[model samples]
Target chain A: MQEKQKPYAYAKSLELFARAAAVIPEGIYGHQNPAFVLPGACPYFADRAQGGHFWDVDGNQYIDFQCGYGPVVLGHNHPEVEDAVREQMAKGSCFNHPTRLMVDLAERLTSLIPAADWAAFAKNGSDVTTWAIRIAREYTGREKIVMARGAYHGAHAWCTAYPGGVLDDEKKHILSMRWNRLDDLENLADGHKDRIAGIILTPYHHPTYAAQEMPAGGFWEGVRKICDREGIVLIVDDIRACFRLDVRCSPHYFNIDPDILCVAKAMANGHPISAAMGRKNFRESAEAVFFAGTFWSSPAPMAAALKTLSILESTDAIPKMERLGRKLKTGLEELGQKHGFRVTASGPAALPYLTFDDDPDLYHIQAFSRHMISRGIFLHPHHNWFICAAHTDEDIDYTLETADEVFPEVRKEMES
Target chain B: MDEILRASLFLKAVLPLMEDLVDFDTIAASAISDKRLILQFEVKNGPSSHLRIEGGKIRHGIGMHQSPDIRLTFKKPELLNRMFDGEDVRPGLRKGFFHLLFLIREFPKLAERLQYYLEGDGKKAVDEKTKNFQVRIGLHAMLGGMATVASDDASLRSIADETPFGTLLVRILPDGPFGTFTKLSHNGGYIFESTFNQPVRHANAVMEFAGPDAAKKLIDGALNAVTAIGLGQEIKIRGLLPLIDKASIFLYRFGKIMGV
Candidate 1:
């Protein structure tokens, strides 16, 4: 039977899957992680990858939107990057002693991002964000840290805990202020001026659910002037959105520079790495700042990141993304209109979002996300999709085709 | 625990670990006086749940009646099947399988309570409750999970003697997270934080409330402003507490003139 054969063709995957279940939880790598790729299950495994694509052991070729989740801007196994790695392999990758590459990387970052003059590195974003907070306390002799309402900086308890339960009373140093609410910003800075250490915000905006409503009017400018006036340090976490958007996803994007700014993701293209950059004056504080790690300073990411930056310097990487972002947005909106839905897209990054008008009963956004997944184009089911540079125009067209088909079906369902 | 709830059928907590289940016949014979509420479901055994409200308290009653102010039923087989299958209750509501049959107007308050009880803490109900609280947080009329609270151990002991929120949460104190937070103002300016898995009727999306604490604060803040403690007057109180996730407490004000 076709059904039996279809499963039997998948029988090899199935047997491994069953064996995995006997030893592992639900037979998966990540708990609660579902595989939404071809064969429509959690991926059994991947064999190898190259040039904008990868395959599982089953030999399925698909465009990689999973992009190691926002790090594969240059795609899998880029030759120049691979070459950099091979060369670095000849030189010792990491030493407890300082390397010329660290300073070289810092100088390169300071030139690209306005606020990043002196820099520190972390294995991941959470470390740098936490370091930024500590630096804020050091820079200003204050205790409290304020975050924009609904913004996520990292998984640290300070950031993780928001609203009520996220931070218990004991971890009471954090406060939530309206992202663009100038009045709240003014009040917070004014009220806690004497004791407020800093206010950190992710310029990516609309943090929760990635509803990217850009900062409005004089909100950022007002906060900029307020933080200075109140002596509050400003920390910008641009880790995930850095190379995806622009190095200018920093305060420079909003015409202001932060006291400290952190960057990671896409810098190494699927290698686990992140960097923190701050003003020159904060450089002295960095000597006292004690963030340590083993794998963070590993050679693979260092080599990969060196190559990533080289390619970025060579090409108009951010500008090319801007054009592609615009193209994707225009296409998605047009498709949404034709298919009878509303779409929200932002920035010229690999990730642009396509969402419907807000409706409670009909979570059209969720439905659309599920639809995109059912097709080969797997995206983060979100309002703002992270678009990697690897996604070709053909990929976007296929996604559009799927959207066109899905919308009419959805509309019919809504009518019934 | 409040005096009334302690007096009610709240003794199961003290039994030895192995002797978990309670003998309802013994509890009913000791606690009841005249009648019982009918269990309408053919499975849970009908006409079994009964209680009498007097002076402002609820207690078990003798005998069984087909009709009562409140009657809740469960199909034993269906419940067992669901339990055995480990089918989570929240999804079943979203799928629209369960039904609550009732006469809407016969007992208004109790019907509303039953609605809250049955839908309990499903996602939709808890979400609705959360939305309601979020939108109306600044207002004192509805609970916003933020209550103005005060800690007067003596007052909490005396005042929350009958309220359900006070009843279950009164005595057993948690050493971590929430400890001795069993007091709330009935209509107080109170603030507390809670999150429901999903909004279900009477299911708390966010549990923090400024119930009795707010009530007391408002009344004490300006007693001349508080004349009649009725529907819109705001009953500033002692403390009313919140029940945990899987458990719920039943609190009913007494007499025809109670809520008003």
Candidate 2:
């Protein structure tokens, strides 16, 4: 194909969509996104990717904060990853049964992660989380699992329709609790006792506007105590925050090891793979659950995962990422402070969520998203940002510099 | 500064749909203007007043207040920038920051018009370059048909005399999907409900609607109508502003032009 500048740029994406929509549903793979939420349309195609930048077929480049919805950890198409995948591809991507590499993977993971006495794999986060629930159901023989209010577990039919609707089907086997709050959870927990199988949380709330806030004042420890007392399996849905928090062994970071921990995104370098690492108690039950996919055990992704984890651990990826994240965060805070607007940026080192301090309209999200899109950056008005290993000091500087320039303009649009 | 000019132009393009919904001519005649191009629209129920500028200065036209109504406050440049910048003025008024208050009963029709107005201007949008030129919709209802230009320059290279329906004001759009624009004779003209295809490029055109009822009727018909014809040339609608009813009216007009 002919070379262009940035592929994720909006205009070019639209051009590709004008053609692709003719064939695919909504013109791309998967469900429609906020990009298609507007009266207008989302861009159609991604032309190329390298490191922290991606280009659209129309030749617009962006610093890629979207990070493919939190998966491109080592940056887009790292050469090492590609080389590994290429080499693995030469030997074939998969074999029907468990590969010898799986043994190595499970063994290494058991050693590297504190809570991962046993491990299992799937193609996406949803699979692992769902498996955890299955294990919970079988282990305790409980009919229901407790989910934090607004927590997003995955794309399963049960996970998608959890909140805000009069849902009867998915709500079963899933009791609910509020994140970052001990009282709400304890109140709900008292009523459930042994009927509750597991409490799935995001380390932050999953679905609402208030998602991405960390657990405040030992909330996690309290919840852990509650789960331990009640014999409820605690499942941390770290799929979203896994590598970004610099916690290779995140279950230990908060010093609360849930019985089962599920992680995906940034694990296999944009490759579709998710692993649910657990304590020794539930490994056999997890393996027996009907959690299998034809594309699950690809050697390419296996090799990619091994390489990605190696780099993240070897180069101290999380620390370097945190430095850049701090720079971006500091700049955003300063911009909000300077504008005298209620603006704040929070969340982890890799992904940051910025919003107006007090009053936030969805329009700010839309306006900022479009403003950045037109400027060749794609900002989702919906959720937290995904910062990848590819992001550099220069990239953070440029992004912060852009914020300094644009914040005043956005302020003009604010109510005050 | 975001160009308010682009906002105005976008408003003009969508206004045909609004006109189809409400009798804008009746509403326009009802509103007392300062008799200048700086038109101000005082919506009835809604808490918004729209002002139009012609010579880069706000004089008086749509709903301008010489005493500078706080019921219609003016931050002057800041307000203008925000409007063009795509800010919603409704909440501003609610918060006492926009400071313009209107009794819901006082400006009901005008409220609809205000929504149309804001929807067009796009408070926070940057100006985009239009690919097509402009066209005019001739108004035959008053003064033996006033020729309205879709853009400042209204020109048609070719128009299809025969529509699928009846004797109608068939405007040949500048460009369309098939690289052609057709002004088809239909069951109804700009007043009747119809459909039109959206062109890739912006086009300016003049429309000719007979009466207020025709405009409103055209809007209602188009809402239920499911037809679309393509604009063959670069054409855009101009000389129109957002009127709540105007948005509904444009839907039909756009629908009819595209064979809706």
* TM-score, B chain alone, candidates in order: 0.19, 0.23
Model 2, span A1-416: residue lDDT tens? 21223223355555555455555543553333222222232344577888888876766777788788888987998999889889988988767776776777778777888878988777888888888898988888887787765567877766763122324555555666666778877887788767888888876653434326766878888989988888888888889878676545556655666788898888878988889998888877776677778888777788888888888888867887777878887887887688676666777756787766553324454455555555656565556777877788878877766666566766666455
lDDT of each: 0.50, 0.54
TM-score of each: 0.61, 0.61
Q: Write the per-residue lDDT of candidate 2 for residues B1-260, one digit (tens) a residue.
A: 21222222222333332222232324533432222222233333321233332222222222234433333333343453344344645322312223232322213444455344323333443232110111112121110111111111111100111111121222332222111121323356422122333232422112323233233333334211110100101211211111111222333333333222
Model 1 regions more than 4 Å off: A1-32, A35-49, A54-62, A90-94, A162-170, A247-249, A347-349, A360-362, A413-416, B1-260
Interface RMSD of predicted model 2: 15.8
Tell me the lDDT of candidate 2: 0.54
TM-score of chain A taken by itself, candidate 2: 0.91
